[model samples]
Structure formats: structure tokens, C-alpha cells
Target chain A: MKKHNFNSGPSILPQEVLQQASEAVLDFNGIGLSILEIGHRTSWFVEVINEARALVKELMQLGEDYDVLFLQGGATTQFMQVPLNLLDKDAAAAYCVNGIWGDKAVKEAKIFGNVNVVSSTKDKNHSYIQKDFSVPSDNVYLHYTSNNTVEGTQWHTTPNTNLPLIADMSSDIFSRPVDFSKHSLIYAGAQKNAGAAGVTIVVVKKDILGKTNRNISPIMDYRKHIEADALLNTPPVFAVYVSILTLRWIKKEGGLVEMEKRAKERADLLYSTLDSLPVFAPIVAKKDRSLMNATFTTHNKELENLFLEECKQQGMIGVKGHRSVGGLRVSMYNAMPISSVQALVDLMIDFNRRNG
Target chain B: MKKHNFNSGPSILPQEVLQQASEAVLDFNGIGLSILEIGHRTSWFVEVINEARALVKELMQLGEDYDVLFLQGGATTQFMQVPLNLLDKDAAAAYCVNGIWGDKAVKEAKIFGNVNVVSSTKDKNHSYIQKDFSVPSDNVYLHYTSNNTVEGTQWHTTPNTNLPLIADMSSDIFSRPVDFSKHSLIYAGAQKNAGAAGVTIVVVKKDILGKTNRNISPIMDYRKHIEADALLNTPPVFAVYVSILTLRWIKKEGGLVEMEKRAKERADLLYSTLDSLPVFAPIVAKKDRSLMNATFTTHNKELENLFLEECKQQGMIGVKGHRSVGGLRVSMYNAMPISSVQALVDLMIDFNRRNG
Candidate 1:
């Protein structure tokens, strides 16, 4: 059976990337040693981490002023790391509470400094992105999740803010192009549009660090990591290697411009089908719907499981929505082909016709 | 070419584990989903992390009171997290500074609380483990590196401490059995004796946590990770899976007892050869030498590179020592076969004969 992977993340990766990653595990670059066996500091691996970092910088169209680091503990770790490094004690940091991830990021910031919630969509079940947020002067940074996987909403525009903008691009990074040079820092967990689940890519503007007078633990301090060039300690070697492979694929497929075209195409197909089907409806505000995760629910809540069962039978995996948001979600990352979206659309149409 | 792998971790792993791990990257369990492509919360991956955690407990011979967590960030991250969760601002942590890792642990702990140096062998270049030192009674925890990879020393016995005991067994874990339940906390980066590089195994006595009362960041707090069953955030899915396969290999190979036996056998062979050879010298205190990493240098410093060149010619990988400790280190972990040890010993004897 040909299975279509629609799981939100640790989601889909390009086929060639998977092939190379699999081979490397057994024998890395024809080196007698498995990648699992090599030292992190070895020339082969240093080249890997260095190349991966360079690729990120190139893809984001950023310059020498921005440094790329491959850190561990995923984007969630960044939730606190961002505040721990950037937010000064007594000075406030601005945050937007749009979903669970954003909410969690806010909670972590509160521990380090006063958090000013400049915007929130939580009041409406995070159904839409807030547009009129204002970051107060003297705030250290304005933070928001660029895409909410659970809410199935994405901020297509970078929120207008003068405070050094920080975006958690974990779920929708590489699915489209943005003004990457504008943000002071952008981070993405590799599980989504990148590669595997272990590494987190952090792109930070070099000048923004060391201003917080707090005695930061060296590992948590961005300045320390940047000074060492992401080799301050042993990194997650295999995860970074896979990220290199995935990033290479993204670049070879004509960079984020093409990724955006494909993303819009997939999202359009799924959304147009949902709009025409009276029995099914997208739960997120139409303009705010995520290009990565397409969330919807049936007019009859009882039919959600039945539709999921139909999806399972058709070998469509992970179309079910998050437990928090009880609906169906079709996650189409950059690696997701238009055919997979068409397959899901076909299922939805078939499901709606019979149920209606 | 049959290569002998003695590189330090992300070192050697069971050949069978690599085979299975590689295959799963393409298609996991005949499920048509690459392990990389599955959602972390899905039942398939949940079972992997659970099994890896359970395997750690069973192999350590600890009961259920010790909760195992597969966290991201290497054991280095635990340097700060241990203090963040265990030490209060007023309470002090007692540490033994045996190597750079211990020094780092001390530095990170100082960020959270007062640190008392219980013992230190740095005065003699970390050539031996410090003994006959006392940890103060009021200390939050007595911390030590069970194995110093750089200095190449090992603590054969757990220190006698009335304070809560914590061990960073990043290099020597699973290579030997000890009174594991005696410690309040034990952590190891999976790259060494456990599995791959992306995950770290944290075994903690449940009662030891939640006592610090110092507004610990939930992610940094072990209690939260334990509560969520190592799924608090996206785990290193593929790394944990590889750990599952590696742990299963350990159990199938007769658990830690047999592993310890093999560790002794390999170390005995390598040490005996070095002791007999007039051209070679083991740098560390003989009684304190690590069974995992055997660090040594040539009697004539000029011959060191020549020996490494010979090692490279024989298809031995990662034989170079860390620059901080400029000497050759042959790391023979659990998966290292005695034949490879014999090959190295054979080469050492042959070189000694020609050089002498």
C-alpha cells in the first residue's frame, strides 16, 4: 500500500534525504565507521555541521551578521533559552499567545522577566492570528510563533515590531520564504520541514547577545555557543547530518521560492475542496489558515472518527487533528507532494458525498 | 576491509543495532513510514521511548521508583539542569573536580547555587581520582564524573557521601554494574554506551525532585519530563528508537555483568601490552585507568603521529586523542570486540619491537 504521511511532524522528509540518511547510519560517506560511531569533532563531522550552518545562512539570505547554530532539546528548549539569553531582568519582553506553543513560550519568559502579552488569540480558541499587536518601547524582544500547528493558523506576515523580533518557525519553516533578515532570531525544530526530530536550528543576529547582565550558564548563553561556532560541546551529530541533507534538498528544489509555490498549491487544493464540501469545514479563519496544517471538522462531530477510519483504510496517516482541537488536520509540509493533497481531497469529497 | 573502531563516543554500537536502525529509517516495522516521518505522539514512537526507558531501569537493576527520561541535549545540558532542579539558591552542591567535564558541571552549578569542591585531582593534572575527601552534610548533592574521557580516569567505587549522590556517567555507563540504586540521580549521553548522539538518558529517584522549590523551568525540571513520560515535548524519535535496539542488544548479550567482564578483558589486554612495551606509556594513574578509554603517549613524543599513522593504515578509526589531552586514546566501549583489542595490542607489540 502506498501510504501518504500527513502527520504534523517528525513529519515528512524528501525521499532522497531519507535514502542518504539511512545509508549514513550504516556507513557514513563510505567511511568504514557508521555515523553513529564517529566522533563529533572529527573533520568529516565538522564539515557536516559547518556545511549545515552555511546552508541555513544561504537559504535564509542572511549575512555574516547572523550566525546559525544547531542546538538540541528542540524548539521547546528555545522557549526558555530565548528569554534566558535575550530578556533582561526587570525589563519586559513582548509575547503573542496564539496557541499552546506560544502560551508555553510566554510562561517561560515570565520566569526570566516580566512578559508583556502584546497580542493573544486564545480567547477565540486561537482560531485567528492577531494583526494589531503593539510592542512597547524598551521591551527586549517581541516573540510569536509564526505557525501554530494545533490551531492550524499561520501569520503570513511578520508582525510589525521594532523590538528585535523572534519567531518559532518549528512547524512551517522552509515551507515558504519570509523576510528572514528582519528577525533578530529565528528557530525551527528539524522535525517539520527540515529533517529529523533531534536538532533545532537557531539563527541569531550576532550583536543582540551579552547585553543581559545576568550570569548565564555558558551552554544556555548564545554568545558562548556562537563564540565556539556551535562546537562548544558535542552536538546531536546524526540529527544535524539529516538536516544538512534536507536543506540540500530544499536548495536543490529551487529554494524556498519553489517550496512556497508547492505549499500554496497544496493548501489551495485542500482548502478549495473543503470549501465546496458542505459536510466539511475548516475550523480556522479562512485568511489565517495554515499552509502547513489544514484543520477541519465535519458538520456532524460524530462523523470525525468515521472519516478518520476511512483515511486509515486508504493508507492516509496522521490526518487526525490534535486532541486539544478536536477536528481533522491534514499536515502538508514542504516535502509533501501535491499528489498527497489530491489524495486527501479525494477522500474528503468521497466522505462528504456519502455522509451528506 | 575489517576496520577496528576505537573512537570515543558516538562510538561503536552493535552491528545488528546499526542494521536495524538503518532499515527503520527507510521503512519502520513494515509500516510504510520512515521512523523519521512518524509523529512523536503516535503509538509507534511512544512505545519506542517507553521501551528504551524500561530497558535502562531493568539493566540498571533499579525498581520503578527511579524514573528514566530520554531527553535531548547531551549530558552537558544536565550540567545546568541538575543544579537548576536540585540545588536551591542558598543550598550548596558538593563536586569533585577530576576532569574538564566535572569542571564544567561545577561552573554550571555555581550559576544556581554555592558549590563546594569536595575533592580535586586537577592539582596533579587529573592523573588520578581523588579519594579521602568528605562532602558536607548540608550539600544538596555530591556530584562527580564517573569516567573522565579526556584525562582517562575512572572511579571504580562510588564515593561515600551522606548528601544526595549524583553521577554523570556519560562515558562509562552500562560498561559495568554498580550499586545504582544508591545514587539519587544518574545521567549519561546516549552516544557512549547506550545508543546514538541525540538523546541523553536521565535516571532519577522520583522523591529527589520537586524539593528545590526554586521556580524551575518546566522543561529543565526532571519532574515535568518524568510526569509526561519523556514526551513533554518532541523527543529525538529516531535516537530513542536506536537506543531501544541498542538496549535490547545489551540484554541479549547477558546485560551489564557480561559487559563488565568484557570491559575488563579488553582493558587488561590493552594495559598489559602497554605496560610490557618499553616504547609506550599509559599516562594516567594505573590504578585509576578507565576501562572505556585507554589514553597513552609514546616514550619518544616524535613517534606518536607515526603510531597513529600505523593505526590509520590498519583501518583503525578515530585513534587520535583530544587536543586538550594530547595523547592517543583507544576507546573500547561495550560493542568493541576483543579481536579489535587484540589487533591493537598486536600492532603495539610489533611497533615496540621495531622501535625498541
Candidate 2:
């Protein structure tokens, strides 16, 4: 069966990336050994880590002032680590609660220090990004989620804040070019658009570290990982290797500019199809819609089930919406082809014509 | 050139496991979608998680009293999490500092609450496990590493202590059958005998959770992950999948009992070869040699270099000693074939004959 994957993440990856990753798992870089078997300290493995770090810096256009680290535990770990390393015991941190991920970040930060929720759209069930938020000058840093996977909302513009800005770009990283200098720290779990799960990429402005009074563990401290070159402990070797391959794929596919163009096109096609269909309506405000995860709903439950069933039959996988807000969600990450979106659109049209 | 992987970890896996993993990465279970692209929340993925968890329980003969979780951030994260989740603010934890890893666990525990070093081999450069360790009666738990990877030492018997027991079995997990009921919690990074890097398998007694007075973030809270069945966040999806395949490999190759027998045979072969060679001397105390990693050294730097060069020429890799303790380390994990061990022995004998 011809398959089209629309998983939010661990979503689709380029075929070339998959092929190269497979070869490396068997024998990395013609070293005649599985990537999983190599020592993290070995020149070969170190080069892999170095290249992956370099690629992140190059792709993001992060300056030398920024430290790139590939750490483990996912973005959730970062949620705690950010405060553990940055938030002083007596200080407070500002968070903009845009969606589920944002809420998680706020909850985690609160464990370390006082958290000020600058803005929130939870009353409306996070249907749109809340704007006109005021940043607390007393807080050490401002935190926000770049794109909400569950609510399908994105910050179309950067927040105006003087406090060191920290962004969780797990779902939307590398989808487009952003001013890397604006944020003091940016973290993204690799499962979404970068590569696979297990590795968390953190880009940190070196100045933001060492200011907090908390006694941070080496693994939790971004400065520690940066100093050790992300080899503070044994890293997630294969995950980082695939992330490097994925980054290489991104570079070959024309970097952020081309990625942004394709991402916009894919989301537009799917959203346009949703708009044309009476059976479906997008959940997020159009102006605040996520280019990565396109969420929609049908008023009739029976019709929604039918659409899902038909899509599955056509080998369209992972289109089912999150249980928190049930309907349908098509996550069009960088690797998801436009042809797949077209197939999904055709299925929706055919299903609507037959069952509407 | 044929490569022999002796990396302490992200170590060698069975070639068959690698082949199967590679196939899945390209097209998982004939689903026409890369395993890398599958949604973690899907029923299919849930089945994998469930089966992996079930397999761990079955292998360890763990009952409903235990909760098995596949977590991220390796055992390093657990160093802090174990204390944060179980140690009350007023309680102190007892730690037997056997080696580098055990020392690290103690350091991480101190971040959360009072930590008492009940005993340590650090005075002697951690060349042996301290068997006469005393645990404070008031301590929350007694933490130890089952085997010291760098020092090539293994605890032949569990410590008798009144407190709850926690073991970091990163280097020795699944090498032999263990009494799972003996400890309150057992955590191992999957890179050793389990599978690859990125995931940590944690088996905890359910009753130990929610007792700490400190606020535990979702990522650090074992209870949160256990309640969510280890799907609290997007796990290292591919790493977990590989671990499942490894468990299957273990089962097919005769469970832990057979694994123990094979591991002993390999270790004995390598150690005996070292003993017979006057040019090389085993590093660890003879009474406490590790069945997973065998460490040895030659006083003659020139001869040691020649030996290592010859081993590499004969397809032995990752034998270089740890920087902290310079010597040769031959890690013979469960996936290593007896033939490979025999091959290394042959090389060692040949080198000794020429050098001695």
C-alpha cells in the first residue's frame, strides 16, 4: 500500500536520511562498525558529534557567542533544566502559556522558582496565540513555545522582551530562519523536524549561564555540556548521528529559506482543502495556525470517523487528532511531501462528496 | 577493514539485531513507514511500548509490585531523580561509593537532600568494591552500582541494609540473572547489555513514589512516568524499539540464565589469557572481576602499543582504556559472541609469546 505519514512526530524523515542512517547503524562512516558500538570518545564518534553541533550552528546562524549542545531526556527535561540552570532561588521567571507545551514549561519552572504567566489563552481552550502580553522586568528570562503541537498555534512573530529569551522550538525549529541573536536560549527535541527522539538540541547564549545561584548538576547545566562539548557523559550516539544526517538533508534541500517556502505551501494546500470542505473547520485561528501541525474538526462525529477510516484505508497514517481535542490533525513537517498532502486532500474531497 | 567494537558502550549489538533494526528504520514491520516516522501515541507504538515493558517484567520475573519504565537522559538523570522522587527533604540517603558512577550518584543525591557516604573505594582509586559497607539506619535508601565499568569490578553479593536499595546497573544489567525483588529500584542505561544509547530502563517498586516532600517535575518524577506507562513524553522511539528487539534476542538465545553462563565463559577466557601472559596483568582484584568488562594493563608502553595495534589489525576495537584509568578494557557484553572473545584471546596469546 502507498503510505502517507502525517504524524506530529516522530514524523516522516527523508528517504535519504533513513537510508544513510540504516547504513550507519550497520557500519558508521565506513568504519566497519555499527554506530551504536563506537565509543563516544573515539575520534570517529567525536567527529560525528562535532559535525552535528556545527550543523545546528550553521543552520540556525548561531554566532560563536551561542553554545550548541546535544543533550538527552527530551524537551520535558529541558523544561526543568532551563530553570534549574538559569532561575535563581529567590528570583522569578516569566512564561507565556500559549498551549499544552507552554503550560508544561510553566509548571516545571514553578518547581524551581516563582513563575509569572505573562499571557494565556487557556480560557478559550488555547484556540489562538494570546498577544499583548507584558513581560515581567523582575524575571530572569521569558519562556515561550514556538509552536504548540496540540493546539496547532504558533508565534508568528517574536515576543518583545529584554529579559533573556528562551524558546522551546521543538515542533517548528528549522522550518524557517529566525533571528538567533534575539533568544538567549532555544531548545528543540529532535523528533519533530530535526531527526528522531532521544536528543535535545540546545542553543544557549554563554552569557546567560553561570548567573544563577542554584547548584546545577553537570548534565543539567548548559555551560557544563558546552564546556565538555556535549560529551559530559555518554551522549545518545545514534540519535545525534541521524540528526546530523537530517541536518545535512535540510542543507541539501536548500536550507531554511526553501524549507520555509515548502512548509508554507504544504500547510496552505491542506488548510485550503479544509476551508473548501463543509464537513471540516480548522480549530486554530487562521492567522495563528501552525505550519507544522494543521488541526481541524467536523461537527458530526460520524462523519469525522468516516473521514479517519477512509484516510487509513488509503494508507494515510497519524491523521487522528490528539485525545485532548478530538477531530483530525495533519502534521506537515519538513519531510512530509506535498504529494502526501494532495493525497489527503483528494481523500477528504472524495469522502465528503460521497458522505456529505 | 573488519572492525571489532570493544567500546564500553553505545557498544556492540548483535549483527542480526543491527540488521533487523536497520530494516525497521527503513520500513517498520512492513508498514511502509520508517520506524523513525511513526507517531509514539499510535496504538501500534503503544503495543511496542507495552510489549517491551512486558518483556522486561517477564525477563526479570517482576510482579505487579514493580513498575517498569523506559526513560530518557540515561542513568545520569536517574542519579538525581532517585533522590528527588524518594528522599524527603529531611531524610538522608546512604551511598556505597564503589567507583566513578557510584560517586556521581552520591553527588547528584546531595543536590536534593542529605547524602551520607557509607563507604567508598575512592581511597584506593576504586580498584575494588567495598563489601563491608555500612548503611545508616535513618537513611532513605542505599545506592550502589552493580558493576564498575571503568574499574572492572562487580559486586558478588548485594549489601544488607535496612534502607530501600537503589542500584545503577548501567554496565552490568542483564549480564546475569538478578534478584529483582532485592532492590527498591534498579535502573540501567540501555547501551550495555540491553541495546543502545538514549534510553534508560528503570524498574522501581511502586510504593517508593510520592513520598518525597520536594516538588518533582514530571520528567524527574518516576510516578508521573509510571502512571503514563512511560509514555509521559515522546520517548526515544527508535532506541526503545531497538531495545525491544534486543530483549527478543535475549529470549531467543535463552534468557538471563544462559546469558550469565555465556558472559562468564567469555570473561574467564579473556582473564585467563591475561593471567597466562607475563606481559600483561589484570587491573582489578581477582576476587571481583567483572563479567561484562575485563580490564588489564602492560607496564611496558611499547609492548602495550604493539598489543593494541595488533588487536586492531585482528579486528578488535574499543579496547583502549578509559582516560582516567589507562589500561586495556575488553567489554564482553551479552551480544558478543564467544568466538569473538576466543579471537581476542588468540591475539593476546600471540602477542605475549612474541613480547615475553
Candidate 3:
């Protein structure tokens, strides 16, 4: 049975990516050793990391002003490292608390320095994005999550601000195109759209670093990682290789322009189906709905369970919503084909016909 | 060609482990979703992490008194995190600088608290281990590297200390049996004997945590990781899965006792061959020579290059020494069969005949 993977992430990746990755695991680039066995410093791996870095730059249309780093500890680690490098005790950073991830970031930033919550959607359980919020001109930087994985909301437009911008694009990176020049730093855990689960991609404008008065640990410092070309220590070699393959796939499939086209189409199919069904309703406002994660809920618990059970029977996996926000979420990342969304729409339509 | 891998991690893994890991990447445990695409929070991955943790306990004969954490950052991250969680401003930690790794740890530890270098081999360029050094009874914990990957040294015996002991076992973990009770914490990057790059295995004695006066970052805090069952946030799922497969392979091959037997046999064969040859000289003292990484060199640079060229032509990989130590290093971790060592010995003998 073919499983339609809607896992929020370490989620769905392209079939070709998985195939190449598996083959590499056995014999990477015909090196005779598994990609798992090769040293990170080896020329083969150097090519991999370098190409992956280059692809990120190519996809984002990033100039030489930006530096790419593949670091460990995921976006969670970045939550702390970001402020540690940018915020000192005397400096205040502005945060847009639109979802759980943003809220968590705000909490971590407060430990490093003063964090001003310039905007928050906590009042409505993060069901919408803040379009009317103000960014403090005096703040060191403004931090925001470009897409909320759990709540299914995305910032379609980069927040216009004079201060530096730091965005966590964890769940939606590579799903669409972006104006790379607006942000000082953009980080994404590769488990989502980029590749596998071990590596995190951090793209920072090189000039934004080294200004902090706080003593950042060498491993935690962005400047140190950038200076070392992300090989300050032994990196996640295999993960980086897989990410390189993923970046290649993104480029091969006509880059972010095609990804954006597919994302919009997939989201349109699912969202339109849900909006049409009397039994189901979209979670976020239509204007703020995430193209990456299409979330919806049914008022009837029994009907919801039946629909989920039907989804499972039909080989639709991970459609169940995050426990925090409970009905269903279909994560349509960059690799999620329109066919998978069509299968879910078919399932939803069939279920609604019987239960409506 | 069936290449002989001698890379000092991310190094060779068992053939069966590689085959199994590769299969899992495509379809894990017959689940429709590729392992690369599955969510970390799913039952499949949860089981993998749990079993990997269990294998660590079973192999080490560790009781429930210890907690196992599969983290993201490599040993370098642990260098600072170890002290951040264990040390405070007023406290001091004792260190035994054996090699490059120990020097790095010392530098990182000094950032969090005062470090007392109770023993150092820098006096002799870390070519030997310290036998006469004493652990400071006043320090919070005594830290040391179990095996020096770059310098090719290992501590055959643990330093007896009244205070807590923390070890960075990056290169030698699982190469032999260990007395699990002797240490407060043990960390190893999984690129060596365990599996692949990305995941770090941290076994911390439960009683040793939450004693520090400093505020540990949430991601850096072992206590937080422990409470969350090492899933404090999204773990390196693919890396952890591969680690699980490697752990299973270790157990299937009769665990640590067989691994120790293989390690000793391979090291003895390679070291004996180099030691007997007039063209080659072992780098570290025989007493401190690492079973995992066997370092050797010749007085003549041309002869060394000729030997390396022959080795490479004969399908021996990763024999090149670390740049800091210009020579040859054959890292014979547990997965390296004695046959691989025999192949290297044969090549060295052939090279010596033509050059000697």
C-alpha cells in the first residue's frame, strides 16, 4: 500500500530523494564505503556540503552577503543561539508570537535579553497572523516563524521593518519562493521540506554577526560556525549529504518557482474541499492559511474519528492533527504531489457524503 | 573493489548494519512511509530510539540509575554543554588533556567555570598518556577523553577519583567493554563505533544532574532532555534510527566482548607489522596506543607518500593522518574486521620490500 505521508516533519520527502539516499547509504558516489562511513573532510563530502550550501544560495537568490551553515541541535538550538549571538543583556529584541514555536522562541530570548512581544495571536489561539502589528525600530532584531506547523498559518509577506529580521522557516522552507534580502537570518530544520532529520540549515547575513557583547560558546556562536564553513567540528555528514541530494532534487524540479506553484495548487485543492463540506471547517482564516500545512476540524467528534479511520484504511497516514490542535492536518510540503492531495480530497468527499 | 575503510569517523559500520539502514531508509519495518520521511514522534521512530537506548544499557550493563539521551550536536557541543550543566561560576572542574579533543574541551569548559588541568600530555606532544597524574578532589568533576582519535591514544584504565568522572568517548566507544559505574556521564558522537553522523549518545547518571548553580539553556540541559526521554524536541530521527540498527548489530554479534576481541586483534596485527618494519615507526607509545586509531609514520616524507599511494591504489581508504599529525592513521574500530588489518599489513609489507 502506498502511504500518503502528511507527517508535519521529518515528514514526506521525494521518492527519488529517498532512493538516492538509500543507494548512497550503501555506496556513496561509488566510493565503496557507505555514505555513513566516509569522513566529513573527505573530498566527496566536501563537494556535498559545498554543493548543498550553493544550492541554498541559488534557490534563495542569496548574494555573497549571506553565509550558509549546516548545524546540529535543530531549530530548537537555534532558538537560543540566535539571541545569544544577536542580543546582549542591554539590548532588546522584538518577537512576533503568532504560534507555539514563536512563543517558545520568545521565552528563550527573554533569558538572553529583553524581548518585546510586538505582536501576539495568543488571544485567538494563534488562528491568524498579525498584519496590523508594529515592529520596534529600536529593537536589535525581529524574530518570527514564517509558517506555523501546528496551527496552519503562514506569513505570505515578509514583515517590513527597519531592524534586522530573523525568521524560522522550519516547516515551510523551499515550499515556495522568498525575498531573501529582507531577512538577516533564516533557519530551517531540514526534516521538513529540505531533506532528513539530522541537519539544520542556517543562512545568516555575515555582517549581522560578531556584534554581541555576550560571551557565546564557540559551538553556539554563529560567527565561529560561519568562519569554519560549518565544519567547526565533525558535522552530521550523512544528513548533510542527504540534504545535498534534496537540494539537487529541488533544483531539478525547476526550483522554488515550481515548488510554489505546486504548494498553491495542493493547498487550493484541500482547502476548497474542506470549505465546501458542511461537516468540516478550515482552522485558520482563508487569508492566513498555510500552503504547507492545511488544517481543518469537524464539530462532530464521531464523524472526525470515522473520517480519520477511513483515511488510515485508505493508506492516508499522518492526517491526524497535532494533539494541541485536534481535528486533522494535511502537510503539503514541497514534495507532496497534487495526487496525494487529490486522494485526501476523495477520502474526505466520500466520508462527508456518508456522514452529512 | 571492496575498499578497506580506515577513516577516523564518520567511519566504517558493519555491512549488515549498512544494508539494514539502507533498507529502512526506503521502508522502515514495512511501514509504507520511508524512514527518511516518517515523523520522529511516530510509534516506529519512538520504538527505534527506545530500543537504541535499551541496547546501550544492556551492552554497558547499566542499571536504571543512568539515563540515555540521543542528542543532535556532536562531541564538540557536549564540550561546552557538559560544563554548562555541570559547572557554575564559583566552581572548578578538573581536566586531563590527552590530545586535540581534550584541549578543545578544556577551552570550552573554561568559558563556564575555572578548569584545572590536573594532567596534560602536551609536554610530550600528546604522544603518550599520563600515568602519574592525580584527580583533584576539590573539583566538581574530572573530565577526560577515553580515546584520542587524532593522537591515537587510549586510557586502558579509568582514573580513580572520588569526584564525578565525565568522559568524551568519541573514538573508542563500544570498541570494548566499559565499567559503566565509574563515570557520572559518558558522551560519544555516533560517527565512530555506534553508527553514522548526526546523533550523539549521552549516558548520564541521573543523580549527577541539576546540581549546577548556573542557568542551563533548555536544549543544553541534560535534565530537560532526560525528562522528555531525549525527545525534548525533534531528534535526528534518521541518525537515531541508523544508530538503533547499529546497536542491534552489536548485540547480534555477541556484544562488547566480541567487539573487544576484534579491536585487540586488528590493533595487534597493524601495530605489530608497523613496529617490526624498519621503514615505519609507531607514533604513540605502545602502552597508550589506541585500538581504534593506530598512528604510524616514517622519517622519510617521500617514503611515507609512496606507502600512502600504494595503500590507496590497493583500495585502502582514510589512511591519511589528521592534518595536525602528518603521518598515517588506520582507525580499526569494532566494525573493522581483522581481514581489513591483514590487507593493510600486506600492502605495507609490499611497499617496504620495494623501498627498504
- lDDT of every predicted structure (CA atoms): 0.91, 0.88, 0.89
**Residue A107, model 1: Cα distance from true site in angstroms:** 0.3
Ranking by lDDT: 1, 3, 2
Q: What's the interface RMS deviation of candidate 3?
A: 0.9
Error of 2 at A135 (Å): 1.6
Q: Which is superior by DockQ, 1 or 2?
A: 1
Q: What is each candidate's DockQ, to 2 decimals?
A: 0.84, 0.79, 0.85
- Which candidate do you rate higher for DockQ, 2 or 3? 3
Candidate 1 per-residue lDDT, tens place, A102-150, comes to 9999988888999999899978999999999677898988899999998
Per-residue alpha-carbon lDDT of model 3 for A1-356, expressed as tens digits?
66988889888888999999999989988878888988888888888888889999999999999999999999999999899899998889999988889988987888889999999998998999997778677889999999999999999998988899999999989888899889999999999999888899999999899998777889988888878887898899888888888899999999999999999999999999999998889989889999998888887888788888888888888889998778888898888888988988987888788788
TM-score of chain B of 3: 0.98
Give lDDT: candidate 1, residue B248.
97
For the candidates in turn, chain A alone yields TM-scores of 0.98, 0.98, 0.99
Task: State the lDDT of candidate 2 residue by residue for B38-69, as single tens digits.
Answer: 88888778999999999999999999999999
Please, what are the lDDT tens digits per residue for candidate 1 over residues B176-280? Answer: 898999899999999989999999999999888888769988888888898887899999998999889989999999999999999999999999999889998
How much is the TM-score of the A chain of model 2? 0.98
Per-residue lDDT tens digits of candidate 3, residues B317-354?
Answer: 98889998788888988788889889889988878777
Q: Which residue pairs collide in model 2, if any?
A: B4-B317
